[model samples]
Target chain A: MSIPQQLILTFISGGIICVIAQLLIDLTRLTPARILVLYVSLGVLIFAVGAFEPMQKIFGAGVSVPLIGFGANIAKGVREAVDKDGLIGVLTGGLTSSAAGITSALLFGLFASFLFKTKSKRM
Target chain B: MDSKAKKQLIKKHSPSTTILKNSIMAFIFGGGICVIGQLLSELYSYFGCDEKTCGILVTVTLIFIAALLTGLGIFDKIARHAGAGTLVPVTGFSNAVVSQAMDAKSEGYVMGVGAKIYTVAGPVILYGLLSGVIYGLIYYIYRTVEQMI
Candidate 1:
């Protein structure tokens, strides 16, 4: 049952997310950038409040890949920063801790820009 | 006979041939990605970071590279060769941001710069979250079913 449970949920959940996303694109003015940031932050906030971990266990990358695992990294970074840098870590810890993800996101983004046709989708 | 014969000939063409092309492309491009990764590893050693730090450094460096390429309009070219093979990686993240930024910039500051920059990435993030939520619900259901079974 648990095995079937994972399959059914993965299919339905993943499908729902995609469908909702399509609707937003068709219906709303909100852009995907805000959505992306919101999700990562949401994950971070949820995990902080003990909400997202169970999701992480179930979906694996489904939970972590969007922000490229930075949410969990930021939380851990905050704790580390608190341990090492004291209060400043709260301010800077996310940057230093999740630096790898952010940095990779930025760099690979630049590299990919070159590798592909980055024509604006607006027009 | 002529029209039917042509139709039959077209039908004989398999989609797998296209898949085969893509699979080979994936191998080449995937290998390229790995090679770049390996080169980054070498650079990490040159800088004398421990193995752990080096791993972080490589990823961070790649992020910048991807961003820069996105800005310059070159990464897209490479992505062509790789398909999702390349796009699924960190480089794709960079492409998403850069392109979104460009799209947002057209309508002047408020709409373009402030609001529109997230057009592409917003959905990716949302889908990601919703997926997690659904994943959670599914897992919960699974647990219930297991208990019942």
Candidate 2:
């Protein structure tokens, strides 16, 4: 797709994600943990069934922008590993690939936590 | 089953904290897990394993470390320190499974290990499945239109 198309897709996708996440918080009893996992897993499963292919093709970043994109990456990594390692890839492919994102998030989170004082509920 | 038993469990896990600490912890804990992964990958290659084998080690190592932390009760402490951070790792993933299992100790091993463990993340799994289906259908329809155009 064209650059313009890609940008538009990303904007829409990101907007949709934020909107849905907010709605879930306002409407459902589900915790944030459940929602984050849901978004990631939804991305993976959608990509696995070849459902996200069109979006990915049209708006590569758009599909990849949301947390779902990370999932797709995980699925892709696992599939790639399967060809090389067969049975073993089934176990480890996702972790090795997603490790960076997880780590980055963690590092950034820790740094942010250190810099800012988070309120303690009990206190 | 009794309030005393429930209180016992809470004591075992750390008490809840504020959202700020939770997010802060989320970042650190998640970051820590990632560092562990890097370390594991290095170890894998250090032992002369191929990329495939290293990949397998990555997951195993992450899960094992997480399980160990959970068993040691460090996971609960970390969770208290960085709420979502702890939940975001492979280890965090293990904690989610085991913590619920701990809650269901009265249900016996099979039910506790198999059924009850998923109680915490079940809704997330269900929602993810539903969203994936919805997103796929939407993406497919739009793609067909683009192809025709």
Candidate 3:
């Protein structure tokens, strides 16, 4: 609730979330890409079950900044759209919900490509 | 001693990895990034945007910053230290795609940048959208049932 308390909670939650991913990377053969997808899908599932909102409320960016938060945002958007538009919402809701983030990434990414020369990673 | 046994002994005696130090670094760096996001959110709200729109603006700005960093090749250096700290944020997702596109630019244009753009992030987008549709259907059913009851 207070500023200091909020900071502490965000730090702990953010660290713990990263730790889980780090452990998965260190302990298993799962590639980072797979783990990332898993995180997103798991977030959506958690959100659907009505559990993610409380975590988001308490942790703030601790929960919201993570990829799971992104997934949850999509689900939240779809739910709102479905309420308003029915079956059609099911198809468009996710994209509409995250359109801002996705579109910005695409446009900025393309802009960066033109501005900066690519360097191959040394093998 | 045989070379294998000697190598094993050296590994056993090697100093343990500094998990605490790494975690502390991640916490600090990751928290710093999130704090930036929070500040942006506050700034947007102050500029008269509603809460939802403010969040969108913050996210768009972060994605832009992250993509720029990835293009400049600094994000990789930071990632080596920050690890999942950077990867956990939406910026990380932008970094993933942009870095891939940057790397593939060498091979050619279409098959290179355009095709490989989604290689790493493709699964995330696929699964994320899939989950959204699934959740939407379930929520729709629940709402319908609740109204009937």
By TM-score, who's the top model here?
Answer: 3
**Any runs in candidate 2 off by more than 4 Å, and if so which?**
A1-30, A42-70, A77-123, B1-22, B121-149
lDDT of 2 by residue, B72-123 (tens): 5466665655544445444455556555555555565566444665674455
Top DockQ: which candidate number? 3
Tens-digit lDDT track of model 3 for B91-110: 78899888777777677768
Every candidate's CA RMSD: 12.6, 13.1, 3.5
Clash count for each candidate, listed in order shown: 43, 7, 0
Candidate 1 lDDT over B49-87, as tens digits, reads 885576566556655676777676666677665553344
Tell me the docking grade of candidate 2.
incorrect
Q: What TM-score would candidate 3 get against the native?
A: 0.87
Give candidate 1's TM-score.
0.47
Better of 2 and 3 by TM-score: 3
Estimated TM-score per prediction? 0.47, 0.49, 0.87
Candidate 1's DockQ is: 0.10
As a whole number from 0 to 100, the lDDT of residue B4 in candidate 3 is: 100
Cα displacement (Å) at residue A106, model 1:
6.2
